[model samples]
Target chain A: MVRQERALRTREALIESAATVFDRDGFSVASLAAISSLAGVSNGALHFHFSNKAGVADAVEQAASERLERLVAAHGEAVGSALQMLVDTSHRLARRLGEDVVLRAGFELSRDHVRQGGRDLYRQWHAWVEEALKRAEGEGALNGIAPEQVASSVVAATTGFEVLGARDPKWLSRRTVTRFWQLLLPQLATPPVLGSLVAAGGPPGDHARRTPGGSPAARAGEEDD
Target chain B: MVRQERALRTREALIESAATVFDRDGFSVASLAAISSLAGVSNGALHFHFSNKAGVADAVEQAASERLERLVAAHGEAVGSALQMLVDTSHRLARRLGEDVVLRAGFELSRDHVRQGGRDLYRQWHAWVEEALKRAEGEGALNGIAPEQVASSVVAATTGFEVLGARDPKWLSRRTVTRFWQLLLPQLATPPVLGSLVAAGGPPGDHARRTPGGSPAARAGEEDD
Candidate 1:
């Protein structure tokens, strides 16, 4: 059991290494050597954990997804309302991923999974978004559109926005989310009564102690972008 | 003068080569040798045109930007309503780039450019969106919200939906475009003035018979994703 646990730890290390390399530089630039270097493992040991780069990528996706699932549950449970929970959770989740290059690397894994004909993890997330939209509808929180269409659009919009956020921190942060709430709030049946729409600090913070715009990692620690 | 013209042709060849290479294998994986070979030019000649890989990328960005500028004007002039024009043009543009890896590569380039610097090339497009919203508001076509906020939200939502279309062809189609119109129509300035919105087919295909989707060079013609 001890040996197996150690082996598992080593595997996790390699994945983190791979994710960092992939996220900082795109997949093509991410080399096995760099991955192993980041993990502080011998190249041979890295290979021992994963036979190929694709295997490493798969592990990264699963790990990131697991973390996201845990975050959703934890934050969801803590909040007073589901809608508030989602907004706060999105803020927190984006912060976490923005801070850690490995988590951001998960996006690449997602793209690769589609190219490789693997299980669509994005579809799984889409289902979750749909389920949430359905609940919102039941609570009279949605516009006239069907939950199916709205949910799919939300999923796409959210992911697309995230990609845009990753690329254009200034335009997106300076305007994107603020604009998002404008259009979306009207669509919702009711705005969450709990929490102010504009929260200060930690992504929602000011430039004195925090900035809403910067590289993902830097902004992760500051105000909401 | 002949040498100058030859130089211009060589530059064009290099830019086209960069687009093709970037389209097939993505930006980073594409090698200079591959680009040079595609251009059917010697390595020295390729270097003469573009000082480095970055130079090639810069050239591509300029060319793509010019093309996009033409597109922005084309839609603005051909269609009277800015709001309807954006959607209609989006559908057509999606088709234009759907199969042409070159156009897609252009999208990829501008995204990266925005990431590296806060240049305002694309910002102009957002400004136009804002202008449309305010005009709609003045005409009493807007919901109860600030026009600037509403316009920003609409643009973000539209863009958010666009990312979906790029990843999954089925997300945006003639039927889907109609659906989008239906959803946004109510939000418009007096029911979108129905006569103003044009259908998928434009100008009756009298010029060069360019297919609705794919590059003009495609063999089998265009097909929806």
Candidate 2:
């Protein structure tokens, strides 16, 4: 078991190194020698683990899919009002800002390889988001629309948010994410109960939330106009 | 001007060819010779136009940006309900489906020295979304919430939808996109008038939309839950 664990660590090291380089250069130009050098292993060792560049990339893509699936699952038990669920998922969302590039790029890579990990990851993510919408619908969240519509919109929003956020943390900060949830989730939450959830505290831990010269809440409300 | 036009065409040919090659193959294996041959130009011509492989990628990135910018500007006349604006943008968005590798990769080319176009593109998209949300508020289409949040969510959702749609046209068909507009835009449209827009056919000359249950839509909504 200990030997197995060491072998796994070497494999993970190669993947981590590959993710960073691929996130910077992509799988094509990032050479095996470079990846091996970055992993502090010899070419022979890298070859032992991954036969070549695509082998490393394939592994990285798989790990990225698995990690994303785990993240969504971690937040699975927190389903509630859109705002509350978003808030619960807010930190999880914010924490991953910009570093989720491996997964983000994997989706694009999937386009090239139809059997790529990006497709599977998104499939899983959409499934998770769909489940959330159904629960929200059962709770009387959507006013009168199909729960499917809400699910599609939410999944799209989450994937887009992650891709953009992985590139720029501020683009999908805690408050920004919460604010998004408050507005859109209301469309799927119990209509009467949405008011309270939407009115929840101004993005928990954000100091810059309120904006200047006017309350942040007012600015948010202005958007609704 | 004739000489300039000829040079421009050759340069464009190089970039276009290179973009296709890179999309199909990673940076490491996509040779300039292959790219040149694909464009029906000589390797010497390709090298003269782009001093380096990275130069070719930069030009492709620039071209993609300009094309995207042009598309957005063409839709500049989109005003009134944020929802309508969103729906109008879908037409433009649809055209990007199955475009060159550069548009799909956007920023995943970290291997080269090129900047990730994803960041700038997303920021621009977010700003545009934010403005539309504000307009929705002014028209009294919103439910008195923060536009930034809604904007982020809308931006996230739209980008996500487009990305997913690009991979599987069936997953994000014209109807699926319209459904997205129907689901999201109504929440932002004022005077409670999504009935005609959502249920109505596409803009003049566009096809009439089916009521949301194609194989792709069915599969998508069920998972993006």
Candidate 3:
């Protein structure tokens, strides 16, 4: 049992290291030797866990997808209007993306045309956004627009944030996501629903507590008009 | 004058050929030899025109930007509300993206991390969207929302469409762009202004006639709802 746990730890380390390398250098230029070296693992151990660079990328993508799934599931469990859930989830996602290199790298890899055959994080997120909007429509949270139309815009905007955030990290900042919702929510939700929704999300420290040593300070103090 | 004209034609052919190869194979795997061969020019000729592959890519990006500039300028010439101008320009740009390989490849290359120091097409589009929204606000066409906020979402959504369309061409279709405006225009335009706006854009073949041998036929028949 102890040996198995150690193996798992090593694998996790390697995945984290690979994500950092991939995030910084991109998939085409990132090297396995650099990844293993960063992880402080032997070349043999790296091979044992991942057969090749593609394997490492696949592992990173899988790890990121699992986190994304958890994020969606967590927001879904909360009792609220689906529209508010969508807003809150987007905020949380932007924050998590800022703090987690693995998640960010996974999203980046999903769009990298050079890489092949991995989970498409954007598509998965788009599916979730679509489902949420459909639920909101059933609840009459939406004004009169079709749920699918809103889904396309939401997915596109959020995916755009991710892509733009890669170069300018500020694109993933809370102020940016909140500003987007502030503009969109008023148009999307009915009068009552709009009043009930929090475009700025739950609270500053709502999800920050979950990530130990995660600095919320870096994300604060932006003029949010 | 004949020599200069011939030189211009050769340069244009090389840029067109490079865009085709880059679109199909991506920038990393695309080769100068293949580009020249596809252009039916000797490699010595390719070298004469471009110092290297990056030079070729720069030319493609420049040509694409010029086409985009012309599309924007053409729309700006028509006397209309700034909001409608924004809508029409978006439609024309989407159609151009679908038919024009150089334009499409230029957008793809803009987001490519491997390439460096070229005009950012998204930023240029975003700036234009911002200016138009500001103009609409001045015209009292916008319903109290800050133009900058709307601009951010619009830019993100449009950029998202461009990025998503890379994999699935449907995202860049007139129908898809029209659907986006249908959802957004109502929320964006003031009540008096909304009635005058056309979400489906000017007319079929309005700008499609400009592209020689272009097929608007392939783009037709998608359900608008």
Identify the candidate with maximal DockQ. 3
Chain A only: list TM-scores of all candidates.
0.75, 0.74, 0.91
lDDT values for all models: 0.56, 0.59, 0.80
Report the C-alpha lDDT of model 2 over B67-109, residue by residue, as the tens digit: 6666556545535445555555654555464544566444334
Clashes of each: 9, 26, 0
Which rank order by lDDT, best down to worst? 3, 2, 1
lDDT of 1 at A8: 92
TM-score of 2: 0.74
Which of the numbered candidates is closest to the native, going by highest lDDT? 3
DockQ of 3: 0.43
Q: Residues A72-157, candidate 2, lDDT per residue (tens digit)?
A: 55654534465345444444644553446566555434543323443466676667667766666677766666766666766677
Model 2: what is its DockQ? 0.38
DockQ of each: 0.22, 0.38, 0.43
Q: After superposition, how far is residue B102 of candidate 3 from its true place, in Å?
A: 1.6
Point out where model 3 deviates above 4 Å.
A203-205, A209-224, B203-224
Lowest lDDT 10-mer window, candidate 1 chain B?
B214-223
Q: What is the interface RMSD of each candidate, in Å?
A: 5.3, 4.1, 2.6
